[model samples]
Target: MQQATPLQARVEGGGTPTMANWSLGSEAGVLKDVLLGPPEGFRWMGLENAAWSSLVRDTLRRGYSFDKQLAMRQHREMVSAYEDAGVTCHFLPLDEYNPYQVYARDSSFMTPYGAVICQMANPRRRGEYAACLRFYLERGIPIYDMVSSGNFEGGDFNIIGEKTALVGYTDHRSEEIAARQVAGWMKDEGWEIRFAPIDQFYVHIDLMVCMLNERCAAVCLETTEDDIVDWLKARQIEIIPASFKETMALGCNVVALGNDRVLSTAGAKDLNTKLRAAGFTVYDPDMTMFTWAGGGVHCMCQPLNREAA
Candidate 1:
């Protein structure tokens, strides 16, 4: 077995028990799978607007280096958005040399205890895990675990609450039971975890659901499983519903930036209004391309660390 990265293994001990904060570079981790072509399912996928927002295929082409620069500027703006919200956003280099932009492979999972670097099932995305794992190691972060199960992605994981997460394993990607392991591990560590199923088209649960506060969440009821919805409700988490149409546009993909605030894509007006009514400050940046890539503000960012509650 490979030795853990410096970040994966703790040093003798020190620091004020600081939590980690992480985010992905648009140029390095954006996907160009044929399956994402034309962004067919979403009528809003447009390259024109993608210019300043999404990390599109053309942005990686040597011929469109200009577009790449524009994309980077927008990416920087996105980082600034996070910083303004009291969330620290870190960026690594854009690994476009990798044909699939899979340079910094791994899921965006950071826990108070440690970070669990993922093992991507897709060969194209496999390299990224190593890159991120190495980063955490060099930076002195502890490694929680790696998804050696040969099936996992950061997209499938959601931090519903600290210590408790909902890991979704889609029938089309990984075994449904794979997530059960997460719950098991969390339980042993005084954490709680649940496995939830999301449609393959949605990619992961985060695309359709997110917690806005301790008692409120924004969900696209049309895509979330009935039971999971019920379970959430049982916890007194008010489910603020979004329309399937908006959800398909990646409107359901929102990032919480502490202080009852969230960063959203442009078209999430209806959901934004709802969140505002419920008490939240919403910010919409240049998301044309980010939205086209089938990921919105949240997918574009991997919250590496958050302050412990």
Candidate 2:
């Protein structure tokens, strides 16, 4: 087991509290602690600009109405499922009402040293980075650094191995410059960075590629760049290809809990079958309604501590 990195909470005056052990390395490590966003105050009824928002636009475009209550239920179920898996879970304090804040993965990126606060592309999400930074600070977690050069989000990063990371840039969300900035930081830490150029349609890299275990990955071959595939092949990582339709359904957004265990959406039947066939214990939670909001299991979670495989 890897030692926990303490999250030192800032005291009232100036000094910080005794740190709590919190550590996160790879995406598929044995998840021991996690941060989940609160789903309260997530109403769509009072929003004037809901029409242009990606969540609302995508939901309506798919011929479905946005249901805040149902989404909350689904989120609660996801948290419960994580708890059932013996993972210690933490919820982000609801300081203010942010509709899209339920997707906590976008707020910050967890590195071996500490958390890297990201600059969100969406103006509405920009505040989340600061909120997450405050959360870590108040808890005694060190802040490795902040991505100030350009817009970046945690969803664009996938830590594959102890010293390797797979990052993506969607022209609309995670800019190339910001990705390069992240690459620079990782390189400084003696890590190899694989830059994945993703299509503008996909929200983040995690939507197309998910690490199932130490040497296995679930990839959407149709959308994944050829170079990424080649890179994974060179790593000797087994690829589980998902169809285009399955990709759209967020089939590749499964979260690995280490030990060949995965948390996936019930809607992704084909992918779940494949995972089970590959000897993975697949936990299917009905996140169909929640995913309609434009993210899946992996997007909703931010791993805070995990043991290396």
Error of 1 at 125 (Å): 1.4
Model 2, 198-280: lDDT tens digits are 76678788888999998999999988888888989899999998787877878789999989999998888899999999999
TM-score of 2: 0.89
Q: How accurate is candidate 1 locally (lDDT)?
A: 0.58
| RMSD, candidate 1, Å | 8.8
Please report how far candidate 1 places residue 248 from its true position, in Å.
1.4
Error of 1 at 59 (Å): 15
CA-lDDT, candidates in order: 0.58, 0.79
Model 1 spans with C-alpha error above 4 angstroms? 1-70, 98-106
lDDT of 1 by residue, 58-99 (tens): 334323322445445555666666667655444443444222
Alpha carbon lDDT at 51, candidate 1: 35
Best by TM-score: 2
The stretch of ten residues in a row with the least summed lDDT in candidate 1 is 31-40
